[model samples]
Target: MMGNRALLMNFMEKFLETVRFGNNDFAVIAGYGDVVI
Candidate 1:
């Protein structure tokens, strides 16, 4: 049951919460790809 968009939104919400809690940092590295700064 859940739609793909709903699932994605849920995931994003969790990810943002994690970042907001200061568990990790968000960054984009060149060639190496995304890095959790």
Candidate 2:
């Protein structure tokens, strides 16, 4: 469970980075992701 949680956090960081520095479309997805989280 701890491993899974760590992996998820890592993925979230990378995805959030993409939203911040990559593209606008991903920001929309990341916004929804934030709501879910």
Per TM-score, the best of the predicted structures is 2
Candidate whose lDDT is highest: 2
Clashing pairs in 1: none
> Candidate 1, 23: how far from true, in Å?
0.9
C-alpha RMSD for every candidate: 7.3, 4.2
Clashes of each: 0, 0
lDDT of 1 by residue, 3-36 (tens): 7567656657666766676665441122123222
Off by over 4 Å in 2: 24-37
Clashing pairs in 2: none
Local accuracy by lDDT, each model: 0.49, 0.71
lDDT of 2 by residue, 1-37 (tens): 9976776776677677877786868766765576466
